[model samples]
Target: MPGNMVTSEFLVDVDHQRCRRCKRCILNCGFGVFDFQSMTTADSSKCVACHRCVVFCPEEAITIRRNPLAFREHSSWDVDKRKAVWKQAQSPGMILTGMGNDLPWLNVFDHLLIDACQVTNPSIDPLREPMELRTFLGRKPDRVEVVPSDGGYRVQNPPENNIELDIPLIFSGMSYGSVSLNVHKALAIAAEKLGTVMNTGEGGLHQELYPYRDHIIVQCASGRFGVHSDYLNAGVAVEIKIGQGAKPGIGGHLPGEKIGREVSGTRMIPVGTDALSPAPHHDIYSIEDLRQLIYALKEATGYKPISVKIATVHNVAAIASGIARAGADIIYLDGFRGGTGASPAVIRDHVGIPVEIAVAVVDAQLRSEGIRNWVSIIAAGGVRSSADVAKAIALGADAVGVGTAALIAMGCRLCQKCYTGNCSWGIATQKPELVGRLDPDWAAERLVNLVNSWSLELKEVLGALGVNAIESLRGNRERLRSLGLDAATTEIIDVKPAGR
Candidate 1:
């Protein structure tokens, strides 16, 4: 026997009395845990606890549980750390993980509390009052020049190009090869229905999505995958992806196993080849280089709104200021808790800061520099609920971007096995059999319901705060108080103590 054998994490049990031997569990499970020779048998070692079999069993015969056998308890070397070491011992390479960081770190949004109207101020009822959630994302001129027209006054200088959203929510980017085509179709349909925008990650836009071009934000990343003159002008806006929060300061790699004919055609790469994006854009080494690209994109796209996306780092405020000066109409800050198709375990859990702090610092810096109106800020990563949306606006974000939450509405169970390409839920897999499990129309309806529910909840939150419009809450930190937070943290987020 070999030393340091990796113990199974999940235990799968089969009840013969309840099981009909219909072989449904074998067909439903993508991880290949169930088999039948004489009777139904389960290989507990292969289970990832995805719950597909348990949910699909006709007789409810399958049960999955955590393995009771665990390593000797230790405070520093936890179960995950020990298991990781054991796995690396067998196949030595960088460890890869999917979804967001699963580490037990502090979530800043949980500590911050929103203030409501009390005795002095009267709260408005959302059902009775009109609450505005419409948001325009783009640059705004500091001053507008108006001239007298035949009927009235006309603005000689109009505002910069902007995209209007019915709700202050956007679907974050999840690439084509990383996720199934049905997932992309659902997101596009939902964005069109919600009157918002959806990002097409680094992967180029599939031809089927061309019809929804007016509601899309095409991305131009380090690899420049699928970028062309037609693709640049196809969307309402363009996003220049500098870095993603999950793996900051590193490149992206989509393994050859996931790249099929459709993905190859869309990304303009050959089939069965790994799609690798360099760590940094070769043409962009300085702020000046970024400015050139920004202008080049603008000149190519008839001066459409341009957004620059960056991972939230310690010096994010300074970096955002430079991006604003580089003529970007929007700044997208992705925090540490963002999701990804695949990323190194070390970077996803340890790198990047939270979006809350990034939003506060960037907004404050731009305001201090007298350029707050120069660009709109979109804060992404770790946004989970409607309350988080309201708090993000209060912390100075013009809008919030959501990724993992949308997937959960479409039946994702947070299994954290997205990188394996065996997603039973069909949200992260490229195989035809798994991808067919999800229907775009059904998934789109679920996503539409999710956003509509959040929109209503946001209006209720606004009514409780005695604000009829969401714009009133923008950058208003006085309405927030920090609880169970240190003095330094509260100061950094610009929130007062709970009592005060």
Candidate 2:
């Protein structure tokens, strides 16, 4: 066995005689628990018994046995582990974490299915046929009529208009302070290459990324971290992040420890001070207040389209309708199952409604109110595959924002330990060594590959639906059927039986 690092609450035993120090264990362990010393290896005593090292060792030389399992036996399996840990903490009962919203709600990814054409209809060969994934995001005209002008017929533009996207999927908001400059650079490059847009989530824009400003969407959250006149003018559109899917009622805190020199400088805050993003915007207390913020941003940015992002919870449909009438050009809905960088495990594992019900209800309500075209709907939270993207569009989303899926392509293991500021994957933490683990070139390529793959799959699904464009799938709920919906759910979602 290797020498002990400290008094052990948990320990890893490695048989040195059998261990060749091939470093397979070190390479396989997600948590860097083992380090080679002399001719053998030793444990760092931070092991959470993920067992990747023990399972990957070529020889049976490693074992991790916990010391008396600190957790008391629970009669109910419903208790959240992280919440229990928080309860055990001595002080500062706040749950600090990173990444997307984590919750055990009905995952829309699992509930929805993509309709693919079988024998009766032929799937178009993307290589041979033209398939469109273009999406327009903004308010559409309530009604349109062709009129003769001086020369020819023309259609009047609506008070608000849509911004056209080459693809239906967009890069979700991730700030420079929360992520890294290199990560932001990669996202910017990839968005430019893919002809899409990436959101600069609350974090201020870096001057280096200014050249790619045309592909960026700047976000204005409660904190207003990097908001300036020029920064507002930098993006194609502006998004007001009212509430994140994770930690909806709570605020965001980028601990002083994670606020490195670069992040501090970029966010324009003093180093070593916690970046506290308040839960609600002090100025926004109602829909009218929200409209003022929207107009303020629009005026600040010379009338750029403004989007309002909200967490999907109960009463979301009513809230969404109010948002549409609140002068927002677009409405982005984030469901409960979304991933977060760091959130209270308690908040992540509970709180909020599923995306499926939220999207359906909001769409139905908007259509019923004759305001479906008043604002574009962007569905987010736990969108996994191309199938989910297509299904979201079929359910009436103009586009979808994918965060966790994008990070997974960049080598995230979904470890749920990002708040510790020691992420091995380099996707969530601010540590220099952890950030160094990620190669921007490789990570960018992988993100591009993931998006490209999904785009192709989306085209395949559209082709299978006998449609050439993604727009055809929008709000076409007639093609969808509820598999086992209850009365309340069915009524809320307005899902009808097959052949309805």
Candidate 3:
């Protein structure tokens, strides 16, 4: 097999006349695409189009674009397929990838439209009237009990262990080893600032971030990395990560090279050793078994709201129902398009179902079972904009999680090179030099701004829908309509077709 069988995926052009010999591009790029001996030279084959050089070059002399090299066009045997075959032949191994699925599947959210108030119902102006975005995550009782007070009746019972959010959005879990500590700090700061929560993935919470414990959701993965009594009690809520949407039925491996001193310390693993998480919790084979862990964490955390996270699959609705019945206060549904630090390319692109469908089915199933109030649904994966957040809430999600979008707000370019442990923007890599590039304070500000803008947009959405609060939109399928969606999809989503 020839080593050069795979063609370069990108073309890098550096105009010498405009190049100032500053060497900033070479310094900024984590990938070794540029070399400057006397004059600057580029290895186009090595470029991943991260745009580090293009952005850092003071003279703006660099341009990175897709290679124009053409291959025979075929419906099935596309360029990517051909390239993968060639690369595998040269070096046989499972093809690892990063980020979310990039396939061109139809996004269900795009086909679904939110209905606005007209004629019969009057719309509320968010600017003039109060619009409530505040939401709580926890199990709710069927009814509340009240006793007579001095002046008015007061509620004798209130929901226990509920996590309040000003914006009904969570910063999804991205472990320490998978992403830089600066990213975690930024998320924590932003969550605290915005009155929401940030999840401390399978990686244990770093000691430095303990100050933000009130705004965190600590995870207990199959490997139980960094999980202890202190770790569990540190967060307002605890999450058992049964599966991630990026690679549904597989284990996760954080390469030894990326496990630095801090990562090792936080995860409680030896430095330079690969951190592995088994596909399923060893102790959980059935719903009964899952129930045991959920309660155990609840016990460990003094009965804090327990969350069970699972990947969205064909039977996600059933799985979510089981989780709720098993005493989980929150059911986190991660869709196929969720981002990850490392995942097999084959699994990331092909395995799980879309989150939009999962949210609809799960919400409907839980409602039918009369267990909807038993667990708060947090939908994730492929949530790109404010419209997505609104659609998710309307589809029955109590709150939504944003992973890739948060990273992008923190300067991620979606270059899909995170698994390489050489992130130029400092959002993914643990390397000291690379990590130093990111300022947590600045990144936190960016995140705060992003969420604030989204919250404002959500209010606009609520006002247009003639609702004064986000609570009214929860599982209100009547406020939604399908556009160009097939009958089956429309029915499954429980939204009427346009003009119906």
Model 3 per-residue lDDT tens digits across residues 1-500: 45588889999999999999999988998998999988999999989998888988989999988999988789999999998988788788989899999999889999989999999999999999999999999999888999999989999888887999998899999999999999999999999999999999999999999999989999999989999999999999999999999999788999999888999999999999999999999999999999999998887778999999999998999999999999999999999999999999999999999999999999999999988989999999999999999999899999999999999998888989999999999988999999999999999999999999999999999999999999999999999999999999999989999999
What does the lDDT come to for candidate 2? Answer: 0.79
Q: How would you order the candidates by lDDT, starting with the best?
A: 3, 1, 2
Name every residue pair that clashes in candidate 1.
none
Residue 271 in candidate 3, Cα distance off native in Å: 0.8
Error of 2 at 237 (Å): 0.8
Q: For residues 217-282, write the lDDT of model 1, one tens digit per residue.
A: 999999999999989988999999999999889999999898899999999999989999999999
List runs of model 2 lying over 4 Å from the truth: 1-32, 39-45, 48-75, 78-92, 100-104, 116-125, 147-161, 497-500
TM-score of each model, in listed order? 0.97, 0.87, 0.99
**Relative to the unseen true structure, what is the C-alpha lDDT of residue 123 in candidate 2, on a scale of 0 to 100?**
68
> Model 2 residue 113 lDDT?
46
Q: What tens-digit string does per-residue lDDT give for candidate 2 at 163-233?
A: 77789988889888677677888888888888889999888889999999888999988898988888898
Candidate lDDT values, in order:
0.93, 0.79, 0.93
Which residue window of length 10 is worst by lDDT in model 2?
1-10
Rank the candidate models, highest TM-score first: 3, 1, 2
